[model samples]
Target: MSATSRVPALAPFRVRSFRFQWPADLATSWAFEMETLILGWYVLVETRSVLMLTVFASLLYIGTLLSPMFGVMGDRIGHRYVLSAMRAVYAALATTLMTLAFTGALNPVQVLAIAAVMGLVRPSDTGMRIALVGETMPAPQLMGAMSIQRTTQDSARIAGALTGAGLVATLGMGPAYSVVASLYAISVLLTFKTGGSRAAPNPGADTAGVSAGLRTASGERETAEAQPQARFPQTAVAAGDASARPSPWRDLKEGLAYVRTTPHLLAVMCLAFLFNLTAFPLFHGLLPYVVKEIYRTDQTGLGYLVASTAFGALLGAIALSARGGAIRPARMMIVSCVAWYAMLLAFAYTQHLASGIAVLMLVGFTQCLCMITMAAMLLRTTDVHFRGRVMGIRMLAVYGNLPGLLIAGPLIARFGYPITATLYCVIGLAFTLLIAVRWRSHLWRLEAPANTR
Candidate 1:
């Protein structure tokens, strides 16, 4: 068989709406990364405070705390609309920042305030966009679609980091800020063009009682793993009465309860949070500190460091996407996690610039692979109806980096960058070892062909 027959050429791209939406997603991701690079550099230059970096990083996720609620909102109101609306707001915020920069009025406090506000809108955009994948492609092609999605996202990060690094280095922050704002505006327009932009009928709003029960049963049972035992009494979907159905708050509670009770999902949730706490905070918050405090890199050097890691991420995502369904996510996930920790440990001891960037590149590769595996597992196993809410919870867990930043920043300030990095490396390794021991049986078996259930 030909490679095209064996691996498939990203079938999701055949859909016109998805074609547009995918690039839009890329642009948004690109803009976000660019902002991070520019903002981190700017903050460091202005205040010379690692604590401020921690506060800035933490603030970026403050809005993510409401991710579960936004997921519920997406299910009720439609993801496309939610995404488009938020993108519009994001565009405005970026424009405001750009204007401030151009007028020589931008300051750290102003950036922080805008970043916190922007954080509130970010969850809605991300959760809704991902959840919409179910609407865009057939069930069997979901893995390919998700892979392509991740590829674009990672590629954008690479591009954004380099572009931000170069721009800030050359023309300063104003022009870079303009580019970020423009990307958001483009995302807004693209998302508005996508179809299936209507609100989903509330499960209880229109269906008959018997049908509501059937829908609930099917949603719960459709995943590869089935747990028929009701750990929490599920509220019946009241098809006839939208007003009588459980409120969004209640739905959020049920979502939490569902994840807590579902072994696979609960495992995914815990590990995802652990990853954010250990690896990602290091990537976002600590790396900037390391570059500045330890190496004292200029803009070009800083850009190259971030870009090297991003390039590795881009390459990893591309490989995973091209292999498509041939790769077992669970096995890759385990290997990637182990490799990531090892690379991180090596990174801590490195003092040379070339060696540091190379180690960081490998670290990025493993981290990207691990994330793709986690995301694929979560998306494949989650019920369609609860996709938004589940993704919201997932994002919330990922934002565990906020607290992680709070902890790591102080540690970096007190113990210095190398010791702090070493401490996190040890913590991550120990955590990974525990997870491997406890979940060796089932976690690595996830997405494997031998066991369908």
Candidate 2:
């Protein structure tokens, strides 16, 4: 059979709306990843303070913390408009950074301030991904679409790191920032191409029981009874029910309540958060240090290490794409976590450069597998309405632990990198193993039926 014939059709890609939005998603991912690499390098070159680097990392997480509120805003207004506006904000920030660099007056304090401000606007950028999924695709294909999105993100990180490193080497940081800004502008233009730009349901719709259940459940909120309510009750009830007005706190509560109540879902989120807390700091903080210390190399080598990890992530994404559907997500998660820790330990202990590089690739591969499996599990278990808020919470866990990165630098400075890494890896491996054994039955359960409501 031909390669095309061998591949099963993915419903999300066939949809016109999703196809239109794909370019915007790809551009945004590329630009964002490039900005991260450039920003870190810029700050390090200017100040050489690990504390400032931690602060920069913290700003990203702090921005993600505001996503629940951003999600409510997206639900209140149209997601497409919200996405467009955020892209413009990111573009402006990039332009400001470029201008500073051009003036030869860019300082660590100024960079930190800009990064934090940019971070504040980041949640909407992330929320757009979940929103686009709901607006464009059918239920069954959502998992496949998510896999594709993660793959695109991983690919972008790899491409962007290489591109940014080349640009920095040739043209310096000013031109690199300009390239990132231009990409954001392109994303804004692509945002305009998406169809079905309607606001999601508000809280008042929930109390009236007029598609409230549907809104709280999956993407297909339109049940048989929803048609009448959509036509008649929407106007009258919306006019009378001031309580239905969108509230960020209420939305947060709704999401938290779902997490607290759902056993498997909560387990997945908790495991993911702990796993990230232990592992992510190594990537964002320690890996650069490792390149400098062990490889006896410069910033370009750091870029290569990041690129290697991204390449491994790309391989993991391709594997998921080929498999289609949820492929033993929980079991894969546990196994990947164990392997990731082992690789990290190897990276710590290995003295030879070639051995270290091999360990880094394994680390990248296992981390990608663990992350992809966690994402798939979360998406599959969450109902459509709750997906935004649930994802917002997940983002908080995934990104909000900036303090870990902050501490990682100090821990290495005091105890040495190898000992610090070994300590973390051992603890993380033990914790992951414990969680997997304890929650095995709950973690592997399939999604509850729609009619279970």
Candidate 3:
């Protein structure tokens, strides 16, 4: 009877690692949001240019190309170890910024440089966190765990927006960054306590093999959805006979091979890029422009706008966590993707602050529904050995936002926010529909493997 029982929203905390990770992830996320808002506003104001602001935002993801390598290191060392090191980097960078601010040496150029340095490690932070959770949590609890994990970012956004804005306005930049650095230090300490910290990772212990040939190798096991149609003995034997640990290049290739062959992974990746390119560029990267230009507002007003969006996402995460596995994530992802773009189309035209805030909330809500499912489906279905690399590749999709931001700046400057946003939303809607039709068998069908819990 307990097999069918409803696991409560906080069930993931029953796992010891998650207890440490939830707070660690929360602190880290809070610092990240605060740093982003603070630095982003600094760039916009000091330079008095939206183009400079977008460039500053784009610099934050410059390390995205390196994510797969970071995954390789995590797999070779340990997710916990990599995460601890990354958070330390965060602390160090934030402290450096805080120092510069206090010494009156801080400027927009220095902020951009620090962001670039921080970007080299920051893009993989989320993937590493998810990989660690996937390593610790049971399959049945993954949906709830990820939903709760997502709230770390959602709630952090709300807190970051309010606190970042308040700190900057009241106490000024140096003191605000002191708080940011302190949070990063706390997160770094907490990250060191994850479950895997007790053991060195031995990835070779995983029966490494090409899970291609439309099947898992003989010694390799994966989720039912990724099971092969028929076993091919030779390939399985060659894979099983491998005596040496896979080279990072080999591991990377193996990770790539699976994604190349898996229809669902491919589909998820495309959508990931599409959203980053279109939806996220505005909601996430260009909020400053919207706050200043469209609404004619100050830092406090911008904080409210960002918090509104995050509040909606927080609500969505709670609802999805509460629902658990009762709903089909793949189905919901598609529906929400469509809904997100539609809501975005409305957001493009909202000239009033109240209306813009309302639409942004819906935009964030649908964004949560779409992204959480995309992540959960990937984690739930991916093999344990490939989780790190696969998620790394998923982070690569975030690189789309750089181009989206870069191009959006020019477009907005030339055509205006309304026209640029409308164009982006239309393109997103078209591609989402295309992806659905092309991968209908893999994603749209109710019986699709990706659709199953």
Candidate 4:
């Protein structure tokens, strides 16, 4: 009704800390997308094995098993510091691989080793980044902030895929690796320059919930300084000093127990895991073969398909962010789940390049809607002290891809791309339908606002 109300919801951008962290995240997202394209193709070129591609993909998530520990680390040391350190580690690993590529010493086994090493450090990035978003923005602005962040990250993903594929096609892997290394370097500089070390406590960290849980369990309040700020005042501190908290293993177990006891949270996590196992690898891990074998295209074509999905995701995310509050989370999730899988199914049957791209765009749009809603729901429900650990649990579930890819490689090789794609889609649909039936009542009522419980 008023001019201020007419302005688009971009409240989270008004936060100074978010602005500084924004570009660094973009650079990091770009680096990740580029690596996915470059490394997947490179491994294929060298080994000519579908199983190898899956192996390479698995290497990326091997470190994710430790995600719960890293989540606890973030709760202790602050996500900003954790994120900066992880980026630096990424840079170092990228540099090592880059040097190997430039020197003509790179091979599949060596790449696999590097990938395994990278996996160790990579798990922290997702859990920390998601938790950091909750940390930096107030609870009220979180959904919008997350949507905008996802939109930007998707844009970078498009850029990174295109850039990685183009560079590898035209200039070669050496130059592509160089660019990846460069992006990491810039991200590191941006990370520290923005003063990550001094950033304030995360307002969305669920400090009150964890504090109360601890008090109830232990039958006493923590020391005044060890206590969390229970209210949403801007000046609130962290739940407590990390040292006063339980051990990391204990925290991880407690996080697991919390998810187990929380039905909606547990349901959402199981769906996420199933989606990763069935839908994600089909879209990303098997695309190159789909391009070459089915579409009769080259590396450039593979890049095009990947980029199209990202472009679609960017559009979908932007629309969701801009059209804020017009849709309900529960219905959107159901529609997105159905649409995303249906598009993927259609894409598998199509022979034309245009049709493939169209289906991918739809898939991207719907999948983004599903994922963003799921994330917003999880963030809204969890407490600040437990945020990292909870996200860690979620991340571990996402590593469902680790096994999915490993098993899929052989299946795709044995049955061919079309059959493999069909099977995955069927599996995904069955899981989605199960969730819709079993969790329908709860999920339908689930809202994305803070403290929905």
Most TM-score-accurate candidate = 3
Write candidate 1's Cα lDDT for 110-144 as tens digits: 99999899877674565667777755665556667
Tens digits of lDDT, candidate 4, 122-150: 85686777788877777666677778878
TM-score list, all predictions: 0.86, 0.84, 0.90, 0.88
Task: State residue 87's C-alpha deviation in candidate 2, in Å.
Answer: 2.1
Question: What Cα-based lDDT does every candidate model obtain?
Answer: 0.73, 0.69, 0.85, 0.76
User: Tens digits of per-residue lDDT for model 3 on 18-98?
Assistant: 999999999999999998999998999999999999999999999999888777777667788899999999999999999
Residue 118, candidate 1: Cα error in Å is 1.5
1 versus 4: better TM-score goes to: 4
* Model 4 accuracy (lDDT, Cα): 0.76
RMSD, candidate 4, Å:
4.3
Q: Write the per-residue lDDT of candidate 2 for residues 265-284, one digit (tens) a residue.
A: 67777776776577877776
Off by over 4 Å in 2: 1-6, 9-11, 195-243, 352-354, 445-453
Order the numbered candidates by lDDT, best leading: 3, 4, 1, 2
Ranking by TM-score: 3, 4, 1, 2
Clashing pairs in 1: 204-238, 204-239
Candidate 4: worst 10 consecutive residues by lDDT? 228-237
